[model samples]
Target: MTSQSVTPASAPASAEPKVNWTILLLGFAGMVIGQFMAILDIQIVASSLPQIQAGVGASADEISWIQTAYLIPEVVMIPLSGYLSRLWGTQKVFLLSCSGFILMSVAVGLSGSVEQMIFFRAVQGFVGGAMIPTVFAVAFTAFPPAQRVTASVIMGLIVTLAPTIGPTLGGHLTEQMSWRWLFFINVPPGMLVLFLVSRYANFDKGDPSLSKGFDWFGLVLMATFLMSLQFVLEEGAKNDWFADDEILLLSVVTLVTGPLFIWRTLTYYNPIVELRAFANRNFFVGVVMTFTVGLALFGGTFLLPLFLGRVRGYSAAEVGTTMVVSGLAMFATGPFAGRLVRLVDPRVLMFGGFMMCAWGMWDAHAVTDQWGFWEFAGVQALRGVGVMIAMIASQQVTMSTLPPHMVKNASGLVNLFRNVGGAVGLALLNTSLTTNTALHMSELTQNIQNTNAGMQGMLAAMQERFADSVDPAGAAMKAINGMLLKQATTLAFGDAFAMLAIGCAFAAFVTLLAKPVKQQPGAPPVASDAH
Candidate 1:
């Protein structure tokens, strides 16, 4: 299906308008807060799920839905937000979303049962999800090009830093207070955002007339397609992918609805999403770069904590504390990256960023069972700095190159790519870890025979250590098997890191292919082509 180009009702302002820096900055800051809260919620409950599960009296299997419920609806709302924001103006949509999110946060915190928790969490996700892309749209449209670099830096920091620190903050909050504090924490800040944005964010007016030809059927198709696809990705690894009945069903649903949604979107008079922005080559490449960034960003965050908890047996707080090194590195590097993007070619910065990510992942590829905070510190720092730099450059290229009217729609699409990339990366990495660990176990068992001299000596040593036991030989054998399993799992982790390293290295090379973007103080965006 071919997409038609969308023409804006009005062009960009020819001259700079009188600016109110204080009000504008305050409103923008509020929007950033809303964005941070939304993104942070995605990962905050991850480490503390067990507490939530116990509190709600949910089974182990049912407990996962606490997160799945939130994610499915959140993904559905992200792309749809472009249409909503256009129909109801940024200020109104943002205020509504913020208000709904705050109320849902309270409902989720007060939920006493599993069912109640899931229902409220889904509502929270839908509202909170809108805040994310809306900020991206505002950053480009609200700020003049001269100040865009600084704006991008603040955004890059929030986008990366929130998820990076989510587990740490959640673990501490849950430990000191209770799991409910996780949701309640958003209250004060959310209210502040609501007040500030309502007062000062007058970026654009709503086109209520656009509501006339609104495609309700197209909206259904999109929601179904995105929700089904997100469900499949989130649950696929746990259920053994297509082998599970529910996974198979959702996969089919996603396949059927995805094309139908695209066809409807392309053919509709006023489509819900704007696919024409993709016709611009720079935006397309920029989206691809952001996709890779999501893969590394979310993938690394998921992998390291699992490693620490499963292999190293670190407590939640300990794992969180150890992970803070990366967040700190990102915080320290934000200003430098912001300044650097203005001086150097953005493509160059992206290349360097991806390379740094590769170096970090490769360093982790050599991980051992004894590896701890100090061991992972350098690796985490590299990943933190790399993701921040690449993200800032990618964000600039993706949105800055689009025409002013298209930025809203394009922002949603770009953010969606990064999220989907992270989902895909997690599924693939999970599958790889499981398969490789079993393969390594099988190989190790065959290589060490009972008759081998080394095996005999190790068994004898274990037997001597367990001499007081009633069945010393049996205990020795069990200990040997446990050691073998630990070694096998450790090897599998190294393999996972190796996969990430290889992926990042390839992405680094791909970064060079993107066209260079240059921002002028008072001029419109300069793109290679925009129809």
Candidate 2:
């Protein structure tokens, strides 16, 4: 295999480039596994919370942290993935990451305490983070530009499957089995990915031609900033926002470290992310879209499972089953949608995607305690189609414009937005959830008459459960508390759906801002690399 070099645009008009589907599929397998492992872990855990709480005897705070710990590192590690992929070859780093992730998953399964489990989960996310951008970088590189849309489609399908399948699988494990299986299940697939990647993908000492120097300061500071920000977002809702000293500390670190990180990259010749890559108008615009996409995509994904379980009284497995069709829909649609972008302009497709997402949110907003399950399945399936259109199209557009050399850094920043959007959206939506829940509960609890049929029914049940030992006042308070919790959950889901719709609208506005694809090949790009 001779190394072919091009100046970094589309393949040179004169160069008859070859496509390698075999290598690309091999790489995709690794990525699909990694994505499935990391995200499925999240969804599975969401449904298994009740079982986990029971088995570990974990407190609510501990349970929340179990999720938060994994989430923070998941986003933070995304930016680092590019740097690490470059420092280590993309294939090398990806394989090592899968290996590390599997080990961590095993450890998480073995964890006996809440603290230990959260710690191991975070470690798992940290390793799993490398899978995406590195996978895309490799996919885009190995497969010719003609096949990029196809690769993007496959990528979207595989990535979305984790969240789509996770809930049902999680529900089954938690209900029929134990929550620990959610983490343990990754072990088999992870091993397979690790083995196949090692056998199939080859990594040359990456760009060994580069000077041994890079701006170490920028990398360290940036990681600190992103990691800090992730911590704040993940913990902020439970920590009472600005009131907690830990949040304040993390805020100060993020505020201070972020600027310093930017300055270091700008001032130094070598930076962790080639700061120049962001200089591409198309790439920068892509990153912006990713940020918003992350917010809505991950935000909605996180909120739904939680709301269904907490507010609507759906068992984890039941809720998970509703979303199972979603993965299938995405898998079915991703490649075709990617190819469709070639025929239709991306902006039109992207705008359509956002509109579809908004429509789905509107559909989702109508969820109720008594809502039928199929309605949700339809909502999720429709949402999955919309996400595919936007994601695959944007990836094609973003990759089309950058110099091949800059793809890794650009991919990293793009992945970062994907993660941060989810984390920040989680914080924002959860905040809304907490506040709205309170107000809804207050409004619903008004004018409660002790003799009212509903009240009488609840109080009577409470009285019987406690027998004559139950104080009338205590039983009434308990019933009211349960009612308030139920009402609040309903209100919170409504707020989340509304917020997602608005956010998708904003995403549509931003999509219109993307510049047309330059389609230049074999020429150095004008934008500065983000390194």
Candidate 3:
């Protein structure tokens, strides 16, 4: 059967660029699989860090660089995608990225040393990062305005649900198979997508000769800024922030280089990145919304595994199973969210999504040490609903308003904020977890004095239980302190959840600031009247 042709949204229908829907579907297949690989890889590694570290005999400090190395290049490449796409064509850049990603994945899997693993992972990140924004460009350019919502819904599911389900899937893989399988797992799908992309995708063509005028200085500044910023966030918690000379220096570098990169991008004729996408009111609001989405997504994602694995003594796979409810929720609501965008103001969807997420975070706020999988299922599911709604709405709210020519740059910007937000949010939340746990520990320890009758009774009870030990009193105190520490940490987890709830609630209010897009029945989207 011949493929159905789609007209580019930017052009008049009579003079529209003809694109085959069969080819488009094939291309989208490539995009979706690519995105899933990129997002899922992050979570999979997170779920099985201990095994991975031991497999390579990496120290705890050294193991962190595995993640950090990936993130730095990933963030740096994200903003540069627009320029690269225009310079090398989306197809070539994407194809090159996929090819590089697959090779790096293979190398990473085969790596027997920490050095090799970090090197390959960083290269993988550089290539893999470009795949994400390229998918968005294809969606906007390949589909007409009428079908953009449908495209957004699909992107929304991949964006929101992949990380949600990553731990569960990663846990299962690590428990049932080798840690190397985590990297190897991307091979089949990545290869299939690679084939589909090379065979079917042809739009967004570029001239490689344009690289001659590329802003090398701006590139240097942006890379330094992103790398330094990533180092600060990733190492900040372990290094105790400014107390570490390395982190302090990186922070200073980030502060100095960030503005210069922005200044260069804004002033240069042929910049490495385009920052003007933020000038659009709708895109600006969308960036804010995307940032919050990332913050909540990553913060909540990190918190659950910590709570389940540490506090409840659950295995990685079990934690993943517990979190799968959120994934299921996203899958269920994603179609509805896609349909809703075409019928109502997108801001409404954003509001509903943010509020739902807030509700989930608030519901899970009072988490206790004794809480089980079922206790969190409802709250996790609620988060799924929120993410689906907000993600889909924000995609429409942001992308639909921008001219088709600007979609690529806009996508790069949107994903950039999402990533940066995740990094910053996870850092802040982790810091809070450590700080609050310590503070709570201090308070709880002070109340354990034997002056109180209850404390005396507990101590006596513990002593009796350990009467056969060499130092029963010391043993009893040790056991009590361990229990207190666990309790303190659980309370700290609760505090983190509560803070996320407040953040989501604030994001919900921020939804009102978005320029709403209303599509009347059988009519195109109407421009915003909101100031």
Query: Which 10 consecutive positions of candidate 1 have the poorest summed lDDT?
Result: 1-10
Q: Each model's TM-score?
A: 0.93, 0.88, 0.94
378-406: candidate 2 lDDT, tens digit per residue: 77777788887888877876777887777
Arranged by lDDT with the best first, the candidates are 1, 3, 2
**Which is the leading candidate under TM-score?**
3
Tell me the tens digit of each residue's lDDT in model 3 across 1-531: 111234344656555345466888887888778887887766777778888899999999898887788888999888888778888888898888888889999999999999999999999999899988888887887776556677788888998888888888888899999889888988898889888888887766896886887888998999999989988887899789999999999999999999998899899988777778788888889999999999999888989998988899888788888888888999999887776776778898899899999999998879999988899988988988998899999888887777777888788989989988899888889899999999999999887753798889999999999999999999999999999999999999999999999998998888898776755222334222110
RMSD of 3: 4.0
Q: What's the true lDDT of residue 247 in model 1?
A: 93
* Clash tally, candidates in order: 0, 14, 1
Better model by TM-score, 1 or 3?
3
* lDDT of candidate 1 at residue 89, scale 0 to 100: 96
